[model samples]
Target: MTQSMFRRHFRTPGTESSSAVRPLRASAAAGPATETIASYLNKRLAEIGVRYVMAIPGDYISDWVETLDDPEVNAGLVRVHPNNEMCATYAADGFGRAGGGKTVGCVSTTYGVGALNAVQAVAGAYVEHVPLVLVNGSPSVAQFNSQRDQGVLWHHMFDGSLTDLRIYEQITRMAIRIDNPALAPDLIDAALTACITDSRPVYIEIANTLEGYAVAPVSGRAKLKKSPIPQNTLSLDEAMSMVLPILVDSKRLVVLGGVEVARFGIQDRFRQMLKVLKAPFLSSLLGKSILSEYDTPYFSGTYNGRNSQQNVQDLVNAADVILSLGVQETDFNFSGVASADFNPLQPPGLPLQGSIEVRMGAARINAGLTLQDQGELYWGDIQLEAFVGLLQEVVCEPSGPAMQSLVSQFPALAPVQAALQAANGQLPNAPFPGLSGDIWSIPKLTPEQYRDQITWDSFKSLLHHNYLTSFGNDENQDAPVLLADTGLTFYNLNNVKVPQNGFIAQLAWGAIGYSPAASYGVKLAQMALGSRRRVISVSGDGAFSQSSNAIGTIAALGLDNVVFVMANGVFAIEQFLINAQAFNPQSKTAFAPFTRVPETSLWQWVKLAEGFGGVGYEVTTNAELADVLEKIKAGPPQPAQPNGPCSGSPAPGCCTFAPDATPDVRPSTFTLVAVRNVCNDLPSNTRWKLG
Candidate 1:
């Protein structure tokens, strides 16, 4: 089909509905039992509570996009056009994470170019357990078949037929192509279910020709439900038998919670189990807000194996029994803390002295490359979802010897706030541990007290003490929801208290550009879920520059949010690693050009922010930042014009909003604040730092 032919499929927004896809009613029983494959997939997505399908327009995907009429295919599956394919994927990821496992996020993109751009976001979702669906539209079956006959191939294709699908198979829970329209609906259902059950991204590719191909309607089919974590009951019982006995005899049993807690929608249950057992638990890097820091007194800071701060390590070392609940087996998590800690046959030898490790799916205790045996103790589906509930029953219901053992240890370990006070920067802690923010007596430092010029290293003390207090204003309304981008930003947030389920980052993937775009999706999901939280995204300058296009949506929509750019004019995180020679200090050199991040002086951040539809502040001095921060706290400024945003976009000398002509009042908008820091101060803790 030509461009004009495809354009006819999408009617203007207010005009007649797209004739390309027939309407799908809520009660499909009254109508035909079949609908187009495009309608079927859209309905399925809506059934899974996917509110927004972030997409980018492309000829390959236009047919499928036309079928996405709200309440026609299904309600709640709105199409959102993002700045780019990458941002669209990131936004979907953010939505999925923020929805608390109750919803899924979908991304619609075209063939190779579009799908490849989203690779980083999808991989991050897989590693950190975020629910997502990537719908890719490719060339028609005729085009694909023509290529096999040695005819003209599509623009983005190689001679290989399954190349794109092969790439996605490595990252997603399921990667399926719908060449057979008759089977498309069933495949989509299975893929979506896998996305939810596995808490990972899935890919479904539909050829442009097959999108409108008729398939049996799925409206009368069973709606999505959480499938059971397929574990043999007897095997789980046996696994718990070996695990519970150690806990019964131990006095200092510590629970090492991880990302799976929240990912599986069991964080609340896990926190309750912790209270019932009177166990002090430390969250993993990805599970920083697994339990509310202020609410849970026994909740210690994040634990990233040997990468933990000295005090946190001391606490972990003192534990008599360590139960790892769904902790990942990544280098970032373990940091080469000796083979004895994860020996397959034998339990961890030291530190904990006893280790009980289990995950959401199966229980295995082997390092990735140097594994000897399978380490399958009782390997049925041993997810935390099933095990945590059973363990809570084993300890709480019957006041057995195990319960007595747990009781003796409580009120003994000092409360987290007390430990935090003693810590004094030795460990991460909630910035304000009380409801009224009175616990730490964090002072609001005057701007003049700090020097205007300092390296990134020198800015840490000021950042930790002064900046974080401006966030998380109260418990409910205007509560801060953080999207800390990759780099030192994640570490900084870990040091502060993240509101319950408030921290969203692609930590496992360490994709620098993720959070900035994702913050948009998060806000969108938050709006759908009826949340009243303000998103506060802090990103490194390099990371911000990578996906700053997403900022246009956030600013144009006028979301009352704050995005802090840690502007140091270089990829400071990598620079730090280079300074320490990537943790091998012996090879460290003095300002090597090849390794050092070339400083960038061009591309003024304020201009970038303004052009993207928000007011911006470039601050070299603390006072300027303080002034901008004050304006943020004071709320959106009155527009230069009365009833509308005179321009909305900030320009040359003054920040102005387009007018409804009241000269003094206009619409509210978001602000971008860039904190410019001096570069090249090597940070401490070179060996896999930043929990």
Candidate 2:
């Protein structure tokens, strides 16, 4: 990428070091010097670290089309792809998760279609709190009120005046539309600022006409300062009054809205508090993996866990006082929304007035509600720092018995134990060399074990991405990055556990297929941060194939980490749909296609990844799969060669596993007794143990 494609870093007044800023003399220059808005915009983009923006050309953004396509202005700074807005935003969001810090800008022509298409991914970023900047090329500023009358009726143009009204109110943290060309630079600066501020999504609408309009040279004066942590603005006395009481009096309290954990850089503090209070902790989906460093049994709350859904809901509903930090009640995070919409008067199997109603017990807690100063039930002003001063002053018992007690007493080991026993069913009853013990042992290893067996060491945390980094001496080492997609992989992360630095999908936007392209971004960010950390991304079968084309980009880059595809071949989350349909006969929602996946067809993905010069493998069963993972991990670091066949591509005979590879080994009565004993030993103060 060339320097002119992105914004340049601005130096403050009196610190100017570049001779390029020397005033241009009218007499010395031949005629009037001129530049188009596209040139200027691309120039600014290159100034910052942004080199590539993923986008598909649209009618409204023709200015950028004319600009980026210009061989002269966009040389090195811009690249375009022929894909939809979802893929483009997914790529950008993936880049941000890789620790780019700077929001990767995404562009689209304006309308309900473009914005709505991007919304699912953008909403993923919003919910996951991933930093993304979306720039919509508005219809010409001159045509805003007149376009409908010009008889320039086109498919993309609207009869109504052009405004990004749908998204203007729905998803972004801050949004702006520029009617004047002069303000374009400021709008760009502000949009970037808002994206990094609070790590949220922001939107900017630029008129297509603004592209070629000339303006004075940028003064370099328009830049944004970081937003102060919201908690800092709260009065110390008020926070003390509000939070200390809850902490001191409540026996079952736990923190929610784990965003504050990042804001205060206080995962350590959180660990300390959890130890002191001996309270169980539950994080909103955004807060999943918030404290990767600690493997406290307190980590999973009832609602967030696959098994503990009902228990967690009950715990939250019954708590005398629930203390939240930086948590807000958004519709997606709130569980109160009805999953079913059945008509009460209609009989079973009869056509109901509305959708048939069936409610999942998990959807009851509204994380969005706020505790106001006046005690009113409202939402706003949710920040963790407000009570930091009071929090710092409260001394906790360092070695509380509560921690040990919770570890001992909470005994729902049945499900996990059952899963362990079921592993034997997966393996063949053969004399396998390493296939020696209970089936549960197969998946028992923590995420760190997976990392250790493979020599690559990058980890990206969902919250800060850099949490697992080394100290000062090794600070320059590249981020060892791994990207995880949404599914059981991320949601069940608290149980499986991983090193702190691993980045998981936390996109507030909740869009799928994000990890694949975002893996490229993670590699780019690691490079920019001057770290040599290897980048790996793991995706489910559905998401991996959704944006499968990114496989070519990965091979083109030859980034460090292996892209592992866990091919279950179904959208697992949609099971709720099948469940609702099965339970409620009157319900009309059809079950998504889960049964028709060609099991043999999965190997094609390996071939695709290999075709892109990435090492790909099809590990159908446990035999030697661990060894393959180890070899990929130990290989020398090199960017993927686009055309080179992946060294790890599954070969004939090397890829076969017996039909009954995994064998079910039931847990003995002795093991169950032991587990129960461990649970019973926990202290009474532990959140899992009731009086």
Candidate 3:
């Protein structure tokens, strides 16, 4: 196809006039003879800087897997084998997040069951704006054509139709089934570009027969390019005109950064903007760690409506003008119980006149001109970076004396600033006995300080203290931490300090067992980026059991990430709510017995971890955990290289973690620190009502 024709065919919708359609980089051109479609796909992935492809092999995709196995065709891409398709996809998502969109994550799965299993992960990626390339192997072209013509059933077919592709379409930016090998390169290139430009997952279904199909190599200049950042000068000027006047007039201004700032790779730019604006700033829950809280002077704290600290809430609520960047108005973002009149899209109410929201490709301004009509201005297709850049420029122009005078009219942000300063002091540092704060108030608790038996609160307190004492400092600034599940485990860890871009949690989706599977991918991505930070995963017993099989992947791959399982012997979050809402005074019955589980009789996670080819430790008190932490600290360092099957040997079978006659031996060591806790015990601040 001609260059112009190719560009026209693949240009993303709504970006027709965007400057993102520059000519392909010189490195993308073809080299010599034509290559097989599979080889070309791998080359394209490498060219686009994808370092790994998380995968799970199956019958339909065996041919493609073999092609990837070929040393000549594999390029520099490493194929990672997760225990299941779900873990594979989650790993890809984690990789994308950690790489900060510079390196796209890829996952390969067989058609039907394999592809279907990855749908949940893909959906989460979609919602979170994570860029991922999902490649699925389907029936051969001949088989597919025959099925289309005569309804022949394939081995993995569900409903005797191509349902896999249909299912992914809803959760991906682009979904294409390659029926013709000749168009394979073009299709893959288009999907990859979309994945990058939109920051969402894209699905590509390659027919098994097409792996070896020969096609003309793409020329060096015929590469896929990300859509240019649109200027949108007129829209930007219009929006800024409406916003700056109000901003200049306001006395109290606050900047609220959200997940989009991180997703769009604009953390640095956002930080610069905050510095230039010189306003107190806070982050939404998802936006935490977009910038380091410890370093930013004006960073008040995180805000979640009623759930926020009284000081944080007062600071945000009292702002006369608020500039929110890339914030999504989710139920959880607003603490799930914000006032009915609370409109995150606009200012909370009245005198707080000017509110500005800059989204991925949209901008909104509320001038608060009238009670009935607040003179809200909306503009679409405006790049968030460009809008913010222009806004910063306009706000910081040479004619700033008037703006400075207006800002000086307001009282110093002392109340909010003092509160933040106090909170900052409470933040744990290298020293063990850091001053206590609202949530982390207890002085570094030791196992010896507690009674013989460990309760949920004591265990949680000990874990929090250990994490702070171990990694919460400038020296360990880049340590990676993962929080699995959405109950007390997440709640406790959320309050802990994490390095910038080092925390991973499915908080928005609240998916169970996400952390265990996702931690594997996070560690892989960390290694790919040449980081030596030890990965730490925290999970409740219920959530850990859901994806505990992933421990095998860790052991088989020789990854040394640490996982802490809070063995609470129940779905504590569910039971907490049930007890609160369904208590029967007469019958003295709380809820069904199913809410609880036998502690020792249930799956022994410590033994399970041992079976998975990793070391296991059961800690019942703070002292025991302290000993475990010291051992971990003194343990052998992670290998400078990956020693898993992907390095050389054949990949092991699934369920390698299961018990066997002869115990499986592995090179790597993973530790399962099982903290025993009481079933009904919960943190004091945990509320049980739904919003």
Candidate 4:
């Protein structure tokens, strides 16, 4: 029987607990094996919850990859081969992100050639605080020892056998070479533990020789023990004392939710605290959709410093205490790179007024995992997980004397204001009357009228209106995830209302072409959890080309995702950065030859999609786009991911093999939609201009 009892429920975004390390696997308590390094490592992987190890196989890693498919050897963990190393790494990243960093995404590749391709994506994971375990196969121990001593160069090797590990050392939290059988268990366990505890990627190297090497398994129960995270109690108490009164007495409070809420696996607490306190909440661009915007009261749209509506900015600036959770100054989006007026703790270039001017900005208070009270001295290392939990309890459950006393002083704050409501409520002197004051609902246009009004803003406005009215607002269900690739797409990511647990992006890393492949991995994770929510990925032409092969895998597997390829024929982001004036109406004629996509690079999206075994559509008008979107939404139930062996027919045109040759379980198919091309005179965002 499967270990369904241990099927970890990594809480959906905007929800969860602190003692959270989850694994998505069909596990079982298999007894200790005969002790080959392969068996031991695979057992550990199973225990840690890696359901699939995404990789592009190479000679050195072939043996390990093969062993993974051997159920007896791997305890049900499978080896998934994606299009390329970049795609594999992205898939793994998506898998981990979907699980809220509680479950780790594992990858394996060959020594040098294959491992190098993964560097950029792995670095992205490192920067984003994503947990992943990268396993690379190396030359046999004997070959490495003899060749290195004889000064011989190998096929996929650089200076030395440990070269790849050294390179990865800079990116991963742990980088170790497990050359000997005796050291495999501890080393593997340590690496996996670090991935989860630190919420960062780890690198593990296993030589081809070690695959079958006999090793003694750990003596007793095989589960690796989690490292006990100790917190500075005195400092935690001090921080609590300092923050409570400010929070309790504040007249207008706002909870500025951020990416850390999901990364730290504290979404539940964050959402709960927001409800109990009835505070207005705003998600940063990178943090959008972690919570549902539809039913959530007091929820404003994404906050981008000065880009926000004047009233939105003022609502934040005027807050007596703005609790900026999970945001740091290091974010390029806020570090004067995207805007000069993005600082939230000390909001919008205003001078501190009145007495009691002690600002506990996260930059000053928290250092990575350690949460401090005030100055660096009080940064006695109170762990964030511990601190957030304690804070949640104190705020959400105000039964304690101190908490009750504090709660009694604060008045109940209402949620998101109703439409057409006066601009004088929680949002003082607001220009508009909605959660997000920016949404301008547009009227539906006929085919003829849409011909003249086929612009970006028009389409966005119409789409949001359609989606808001079409989908059910069930707070309990997981919503479709929107994965935005880096480009002009970033500017429009949060233009519409986000459903609960809806929204995924690598914005901080800003990797173009990530969303396409990431959709594959996200679908895999969602399938494991029995969720059939469609993954909507938005990609620019440039970024989409980077990993368009991801569509092949998605189609072949019968996965359900909608890829909206904004067929902009050039790297618009490059033009924007090289000459900002190009975006202005006065400088619309500005041209940069390098930014123009060559004819060879442009994809006939429909042909490409068809060749990859998915339905494709090209829409140039508002009417066409709207009709296609509604048709997709109203289509048949998205096929559920199969847990058992592959069964049923593959998606039509997905495969040409004999009907009974393989029953690969692909119950549904993907659709590719090509929208209006933005080659010239594209949409521009003044707020995101270089500060």
In terms of lDDT, which candidate is stronger, 1 or 4? 1
* Better candidate by lDDT, 2 or 4: 4
Better of 2 and 3 by lDDT: 3
Candidate 3 residue lDDT tens string, 1-691: 4655333332311224443423211122334454666777888887775888887877566656655655666766777777898888877887787766566788999889899999998999898888888899887655666678888776787864679999998999999988676687778888888888888899999876456556567554377667746676666656655565455445677788888777777787787777666677777766766766546646666765554555566677667677889877665566534446656686442223456788878887765622356566788867887877665554444234432332344223223223323334221110111112342243455446765556655655665566544554544445545544566665544455555666666657777677877787778877877777677788787778778888888887778888888786777766654564432233354655776646444676667776776788888766777677777777634433334455454466524432311223446678788887655555543442421
- Reference-based TM-score of each model: 0.80, 0.60, 0.80, 0.80
Residue 117 in candidate 3, Cα distance off native in Å: 1.4
Clashing pairs in 4: 14-267, 15-267, 15-268, 16-268, 297-416, 298-415, 298-416
Q: What's the lDDT of the predicted structure labeled candidate 2? A: 0.45
Report lDDT (Cα) of residue 592, candidate 1: 47
lDDT of 2 by residue, 22-72 (tens): 222111111224443455556555544456666566656645654554456
Model 3 weakest lDDT span, ten residues long: 427-436
lDDT of 3 at 46: 78
User: What C-alpha RMSD separates each model from the true structure?
Assistant: 8.7, 17.1, 10.2, 10.5
